[model samples]
Structure formats: C-alpha cells, structure tokens
Target: MAELLDNDDPRFAFAALKEYAANSGALLRSHIEAFGFSGLETVELDVNAAKGLGTLLASKRYAGLVLDRYYAHAAAKWLAAHPTLGRLTERAARSGAVDLLLREGDGTLTGDDLAQEILEDVLRTHAPNLTCRTALILVDPPASDAAAAQRERARSLRASLRALGIETALRVVDANRPGISLPEAPAAEPDLLLNASVFGTDAVFSDEPLFCERCEAAIPSENVEPKSAGGQRLPEPRLLVETAARPLRSHLLIEARRRGIPAVSGFELEVARARAVIEAFLGRPLRNCVSATIERDIRLEAENIVLIGMPGCGKTTIGKILAQRLMRRFVDVDELVAQHVGKFKARIYREEGEAFFREKETEAIRTLALKTGLIISTGGGSCLRPVNRALLGLNGRFIWLKRPLAKLATRDRPIAIARGVAALYEERAPIYSSLADRTIEVSSIDETVRAILGEHA
Candidate 1:
C-alpha cells in the first residue's frame, strides 16, 4: 500500500513486485489462499499470480485500500466513544480542515473525519418520516467480543445520528428465531430496519430472505421443496440498510426491491473511508467524482455483461466485441468447461454424456459467478439449471442475443444437432426471456452492440 501511495502508478509498483518476486510470490500466494483460491501450484504462479495481482493493482485510485472496512469500523467505534473528538472533527470538516489532516496524517483526525464523512452521505435526505421516528438496529453476534463490537458500532452510528437530531435504538436478537418481531411495537413501524446482523449474508443458500418471488409470501428455505425457491419474512421498515458488503443485486436486495422497499447495500456506505482518504490526499474536498468513481467500480466489480442464447446465436461473437468495447475480460463458459475436462464440448457429449457435460458446465458457472467485470458467453443449455441461473444472475446483466432459429449455425453443437434447431429454440426461448435484463435482436452485430452499450449508458 505504501509503495502504491509513493508511486501512484500501478505499473511502477508491479515492476517493483517483480524485482522482489521471490519474497512477493510467497506473500501473494498466502493472501490468494486466504481469499479461497487453494491448492495453487508454484509452477503456475506467473499466470495465476499476474491475474490475482492485476485484479488488485489495476486501478491506482486504490479505492479498496482507502475504503478499508476494518478502518471504517474502527473509526466508527472511536467516534462513538469520544464525543468531544467527534464534535471537533465535525467542525473541522465544516471548516475545510482538509489541509490539517492531509499534512499531518493525524490518526485522531482520520478516524473521526471518516466517520463524519459516512454520516454526511447517509443523512443527505435526512431521516425517514415514520410515526415511530426511531431507527431499529438489529444485531446478532457469534461471540461475546463480537457482540460488544457490534454494540460499539451501533452506538457509534447512534451518536452520529444523534448529532443530526435523529433517534436510534439498538437491539440484540437471536438469529435462529423463526420470526423477527419486536417485543413491543412503537406507535408505528420503525423508521428504518438497520440489519447489522449476518442473516442476509447467507442469501445464496436461501435465495431470498424477505418475500417469495413467485407466490409473494414468506416461506423459509427448509420448508420449500428441493426445486422450489422462497424467502423468509423480515421485519419491515420504511427503509432497509444492510451493513455487510454484498453484490449490488444480492438476493436480499432483490427481494427488498420486489416488495416495494428501498434498500441500501454495504458497498454504498463504504465510500466514506475512500472519500476521506482521497480528500485528505488531494488537500481539498471532492464535490463530485467519489460517487461517480464508486458507481464505475460497481460496474466493474459486480455488474458483468453476460450474453445468453441458443448455440450459434452469436453470443460468443457478440461477447468478444462487447468485451473489447467495454475493456473487460471475456469468458466463454463452454471453453472453460472444455479446459476443465480436457475435451471439447462435442467430444464430451459423445464420449461421456449430457449429464457429465452439464456437471462441468455448472462447475464453470459457479467459479465464474464469484468474479466480476467479465463479458461472459454461456452455452445454450447451461443456464437451464436453477443453480446456474442464480449464479450468473448474482453478478451479471444477462443480454439475450435473439437470432432467427433458422439463422443459428449448428456445426459441432451436439444439443442443437440432437434436438432440431427449432425444437431447441422453442424449449430455451422462454428461459432466455425470463432471465434477460435486456434483449437485443440480432439484426446487425454493430447495432446489437450499440443497443447493449446504450442501455448500459
């Protein structure tokens, strides 16, 4: 981090890394394993290491380093405990003390300034207009220390809100309880339900956690059938703020939006730390650009351009073009599957079976789903699985490339060959339609690309 701060150029820092490659290689591998990439061989270090390092060092703005979650959380606790210091920093921010903090790098100013910055963003529109007029912060910690820490964090937030003349109450609840209901309701529903708990972070297992998409009812994950999906009921408030970092459209947020509620993800609030750091470094306040940079980062980190359609519908072709135009990494799921199996898609189907091919496809999708900022082209039938659909939809914007069934080339496409092109199209078209966030009719490649770009813009 210091190296990057000194140079302010990713290329220069990366070159320094290569100079100390032996030491950096072991250090990088340890961090990589910590992020869940295990069993990495030393021989494949060049390719895998470069990819991992590039992912972190590609942007010199260094938002992730500046907006460190640990620092922000620590700052919140500090502000909660030190009311005098908090007031001083609040006055400092109001008086443009950017120069003091920038020149001194004082820890005292940094923490309070960061906490105040986050508060400013959150209260931009002021508090909610509910009868209760008090926000409820729900916390469920896994340990005693965690409980204490969460209490401090909540207290910090309460202190910040009090400064703005808003009232907040923190409640420690049991997460395993079947239903989330308050012991005694206020005059009306709480102004906001601040989910500082870890309940919704397990969204992948439950699919949703507020309301079912199809039935519009609260159904727990265990009670639903194997293939059926539903969500559990959460205490509703005028607004929901989840404090854990999640994808832009995690099932928790999706369910909230489906139920006509406004939700704020953790990613939105994390900008405060980065905003504070950048402003300190620049020696001036940024009126704009921080949010804009965050929005762009969202596009890069969580919103992928995913193309899906029948085989030979130009998904791969259009995906390549889109990848180049957008300057994103391109991934063809079919190619990834083939690489995993050491065989082509056609050969796999002919030798092993569709079931085996499908397994490999799911594996590829699962791996790719965990990443972001890619133009992904999926196989014709790969997305038919419910799991695959969920995985892709987690971090991607699906664009169905619609070409005439007759126009689709079927060369070496085993499924397209086995089932006639018309039959395959008829079977898969509805799924494509269901999953598509945007659909582009494949009249002209350039026109289709333009439509996708325009929609994104």
Candidate 2:
C-alpha cells in the first residue's frame, strides 16, 4: 500500500490512507482506527488530512462508501457547521441540470402543498425542459392512525406533481428503530433538499446533501422584481429554506463541501442572495446583467441633455422647453446652488465670494450626475472646474448653446459684466466645444428645442 500510494513521503500519510481506501473498499473509520485514532475526533485531523478525506469520499472510486455509525454522525455534524460549503450546494441546485425538492419531516408535511405549487410554477416558466421530480422523505414516522394520515398527504403531493408532469416519490423511515439508517447521497440525492424536521435527527445526518427550509408562500418577497428567462415570465430563482438551528445549518454546509456542492446560510438567503447563487451555479450573471440592459435602453431615450455656453445663451429657457418635450426633469445648476446656499446666486457671490459660489455649483453637479433623464442648464463658469466637467460628462450629453458675444447676457450677471462676453468666450468657448456631445448654434428657443429633439430622436 505504501508503494502504491500517490506520494512517497511519510509527511503525506493521508496519501497512503487514500490508496488503501481506494483498493480495499474499507470505510473511513476503519482507516482512522488503523492509525490508532478514534474517527469521532475528526477535529484532531490536520487540515490536509481532512481535505484528503473529503476528496477521497467525493471521488467516484469511493462512491456509495459508508462511514461507521458514530463517525458518520460526527462527520455529518462537522460538515453541517462549515461556512463556505453552502456555496457549492447552491451552485449545484441552481445549474438547471436537476429539478428536485427534498422535504424531510414527520408524517405531517405542514407546507408541502404550497411548495408543490411553487415548484410546478417554476418548472412551467424557467425550467420547461426539465422534469420536477420531488422526494418526500418522511423522517421519524408517527405511530398507527396518524401514520395513515401522513401517507394520504404524501399521496396528494405526489398527485400535484404528477399533474404538472413532475415525477414524485415518498420514502418513510423510522430512524428511532434499531440498526435502521437514512439513505446516502447519489442514490437518494434530490436537487433541492428541505429539512422540515429538527436538526441532528437521522434524516439530516443520513446523507451529505444540500438542505432547504419550507417555502415562503410570498417568496422573492415584495421588493424583488420578477425576471424573464427564455422570454417567459419567471419568479426570481430563490429557495427560502428556513432553519432556526445554527449547528444544523453548519452541518448541511459541511455536507455540501464534502459532496462539492454550494450552500448558503438559510438566514442569509434572500432574493438577491439566491440570485447570486443561481448566477454562480449557471456560470452567468443575472440581476446586475438585467439592470445593465435596462439602463442601456433608458440611455437611448433619456441621455443627459446638458445645456452649456455663455450666461445669456437662453440655456435655461431652452432647457425648460426641451425637458417638457422630452418628458424629462429640468434642472438649472445655478438654481440648485441658490437653493443649497439659501440665497440667490448673485447674493451668494456678493456675500460669500465667487469661490464659495463655484464650490456650491460643483457640489450640485456632482450630486445631479448620479441621476439620469434630465435636462441640465449650467452656469457659464461651471465647465471651468475639471471636477464638475468630469462628473457631468459621465451621465450627460453636453449640448453647447452657442450665441454671439453681443447676445450674451451682461445685465445683472457679475462675470459677464466684469469680464465682458468676448473675454469669457475666449476663455470658455474651446472647453465648451471640446465637451459638447452636440454643438447647436442659438437662433431661437423653438429652433434650439427642435434641433435637440431631432438629434435625440
């Protein structure tokens, strides 16, 4: 066995254990016992040894391999408590390769009917190609007449699935009975496993399979918008499996890791979280992808219509008309600054200084850039600040509303009155032209609106 092992070094003793287990068809406990250690103390195993054991167990060679009763229970508990293991279980369940729901409970399945309905709907919409095969595994079956009632409900669930063209099966197990055990993975594995029973029972410990809780009738919750797959309306792919016991959640996660499945903590499994798991499982993007696509469509209709150039270029008048025609929100950057400072723009510049006004103007532009579908009228010097220019450039389609120097507004405007329109134009014309997505020479307010609307259309 030593010579047959993959690694020759004694430091890799688990390599030898792997070779022995592969060839001899012995359980993991036997190998651990051979090494003079109780398999119950699995935590004592080094990280490499633990990983090696998990790898060996997951391999096809060791398929259907069973652990000793004590070791099996211990390993199941350990695996259930693992943190990162849940991700793999989630991945496998959402891959669209399998459509299974495993419900483990006593004879009475409280929410089985609702789960069946949801599963049927999911199959009809998103997974039309796949069969919805469900397994109702009854753990700790009740005594006598109650047992008969449980069987009836199971039959009803089976019938429901059948109506939807889903194959269904019912397995009754009495874990309390001496020597009897729960079914192992691969043989009895389902795509979605619902642990309706309390944790640490025979059902949860029996197989290292992914576990889910009862389905919420209104899952995907109110906040989540339904998405479309294959041109069919589908509820967001989310499994709302509730488990109150933290240890049980951990145990299921551990089983997922051992079996190379993705699992998420039931408490953390929201619509968004479930979508993320599905994305990981399918190896494609979902909600974010859909959002990006929608945003692209909106940009076509509502690209930021930014009006730029000299102070009296009729930007505010044209902006109002364009926004009304385009059905977008109208925003004047100078007005935003006035609102922010609780004073008029001229007052702010006179009392607080030109620098103070520019700071407020820049803040308004930065804040407004986060939104879309707007016609923005900016102050003459708003483009002078590179920060403001960058922020506006990100979301707005800059439109230079150019005007003759004499036509520029000089009355009541301090910059135009002080610097003169010719000086302001010399300084700002190049920046405005460089930044403009479209340059429209100002003729009349109606003409400007028509030109913008034509270009936008």
Candidate 3:
C-alpha cells in the first residue's frame, strides 16, 4: 500500500489526508490510530508526543494512508496533533498546482455553469495556497451552444485569474473516446486533481492511474478501482513534493486584457469597468491597443479619399486635385471597372448587361479598398449597391460631390442619357447621403479640394 501511494512528500501527504477526511466524513484521530500510532490521546502535550506524531505522518506509512479514505481521518488527526504539520498542510493545500477535470453528461447545467461551480468549490475547499497559482481547466466538449458558452466562460476565467496574478490554461477532452492523446506536454505538473465530471465513478475507476502518471496528483473523487489494461497492471507516475477559482465573472476588462485592447465589448459600462481595473493593475492608462490595431489595419488597407457623384458632377477633375493636394495617387473607379471588363463601362452595360457591369464595379471597388493613401473617383451609381458602399467605407473617406441637375454632363454618360440627370440625381441622392461620411456641394474643383483636404488634415 505504501508503494502504491503516488506522492511521498509529507506536505502533499498531509494535504491529501485533510481532503480525504473532508470527503469521507472521517475523524482524524481514527486515522492516526489506524496508522499504528496508538495512544495519541494518552500522550501528554509535550515535545516527545509531537515528535512522534510528526515522524509517523512524515513516514512511508503516511503515503499508504492517503490511498484509502479509511486512513484519511487518522491522517487529519496526525496533522492536528502537530501544529507545524497542520500549518504546513494548510499552506500546501492552498498554493499547490491544481488540475480540474470536468465530465460531460446529460445535465441541464451549461459548461460555463459547471466550470464556475467547480472553480468556486476548489477555491473554497483549497484557498490561499491555491490562490495565485497555475490552473488547467479541462472539460469534454459539449453541444454547440454549450461549447461556445463554455469557451467564452473559459476565456473569462483566464482573464479573472490574470487579474489576480495567476497563470492559467484551458484544454478540452473527448472523454467518451478512449486513448485520447495530449497535444503536447503541459507547461507545469499539477499537485491536485479536481475531478468534476458526471462520470466521476468511471473516471476514478479506469483513468486514475493514467492521470496520476501524467499529473502526479491525487484524484479527489470518491470512486477508485485498481488499474488494469488488457489483463496487465499499470504503474503509477513518479510522485514528488516539488510539484506544484471564482465564478470567473467575465468583465469587459478581461476581454480587453485578452485582446490587448481597450473597450472590446463595446458596451459603455463594461468598457469603463475593464478600463478602470486594467489601469489600476497596470498602474497606468490602458493603451488603446485595439485602436492602434485598427489604425494599423487602416494603414495597411490604404483607405483612400473617395469622391462619388453623378457622371457630370466633376468627380474626375476634383479627384485629381484632391490627390495632388494630398500627395496621394489618384484612381478612377470607372476606369478600373472598364479595365476589368476589357471594355468601357457603357460598352459592358450594353454588351453584357447592367448586372455584369455592376459585378465588375463591385470587384474593382473591393480591389481598390485594399489600397491606401489614394484619391478615388467613383461612377454615378456606385453607391447604389450596399456591398460596394460597405467595401468603399472600409478603405476610404467618402465624399459625395453634389451638382445641380441642369449642369450635369449627359453626353457620354449612358445611364444619364437613358435615365436623365434629374431622375438619376433624385434616385441616388438619398443613397449618396447615406453612404458619404461627408458631402460637399460642388462649386469648383479648388473649393472641393480644400474641403476634402480640410477634413483630411
């Protein structure tokens, strides 16, 4: 039995004793007597009795004592009998490395709920020592929604631990499948196992040996059976003393910490709370990491200054001026669309149909959106499509160049000739208004350039 015990360290032995006692509802004195340390009650409160009890608890027999709950109470008594042992056990129990194993079952509780409950239980059961230490959260993947919620909860739990200065990691197990292999060795070995599974009985009976081998920690489960694989006995892992939660509320601050950003949740309250907590912990203002990332993306995306309006609205002339003033390359989306279809926009509309031309236009806009620091001039009806509007918005500051209907150029414009400038303007005015970040009523190219550059500056 002594050889069968996983850990030889007296501190782990004592902590295991207390855990066993708590679970089995056994008395500590009984375990001490069972371990062949008799007459503890009769022994006087002197150095000799304390010495004897310490030696016995620290002996090889103490290892065997942790293997069975029958010896748990006596182990607890051994700790109580010696003040130094009791204190040492308490500290080890609190600060030691903990591995949590969660089982999957037909329970109404979500994975997150189960995780919260188990974490709370572990923290409450083992505190101070368990606080600010590494924890590995393992659970069987649940149903789609439940799994998503569980991942979210795990993310929150990680954040909460970081807030408390604890390092944490998460892993999902397929418990129903046998011979599940770990991706890689864990960063650190755990000191204790919290088996929070519905199939707790089966896991303890069949899996304890493997778990003990990998973790060198005691399984805090009531069910236990001898390890046998294909009529062959298995050996336990090397045990040593050197080894090694809250409702894990996810505040917005936790999300920000995870993203290395500020205001990730987008809700004012959550962002405020996250900001305050992070600032206090970091002892400085929360850097706008998210904003910085977006700015970087914008730079990469090459968001150009885009001018849009009807054909005769002086978009080309104004676009070139704006480009020169801003020292950016100028591009005409209409020309790009023409190049894509291997013909002019009017020819594509006439030959292939308006739908094909619209597709070409959309493709051109998407390509243009990937460019940065440019001045773009768009055709009359580009803002009509919601997709084009969205794509352009992502990479450009949109400005609609508005001109009176009578002055609009309809000579080479097929759409203007077919639909008439007044009708086109009436039809697209609302879309242009909706899409443009800013609108400049066109007076001249110079004035328009100033307005656009003023906004840019």
lDDT of 1: 0.58
Per-candidate TM-score against the hidden true structure: 0.65, 0.39, 0.40
> Residue 59 lDDT in model 2?
32
Regions more than 4 Å wrong, model 2:
1-297
Residues 349-440 of candidate 2 have per-residue lDDT tens digits of 89999978887887787677645568899998898875566556545678999887877767779988888888888998999988787899
Model 2 score (lDDT): 0.47
Model 1 earns a TM-score of 0.65
Best-first order by TM-score: 1, 3, 2
What are the per-residue Cα lDDT tens digits for candidate 1 across 263-340?
Answer: 776645543444444445445565565446544544454478789999999998888998898888999999999999
2 or 3, greater by lDDT: 2
Candidate with the greatest TM-score versus the true structure: 1
Model 1: runs farther than 4 Å from truth? Answer: 1-67, 72-110, 113-120, 123-126, 129-131, 134-140, 143-152, 158-191, 202-232, 280-302, 454-457
Cα error of candidate 3 at position 436, Å: 1.6
Give candidate 3 misplaced runs (Cα > 4 Å): 1-302
The alpha-carbon root-mean-square deviation between model 2 and the true structure, to one decimal in Å, is 26.4
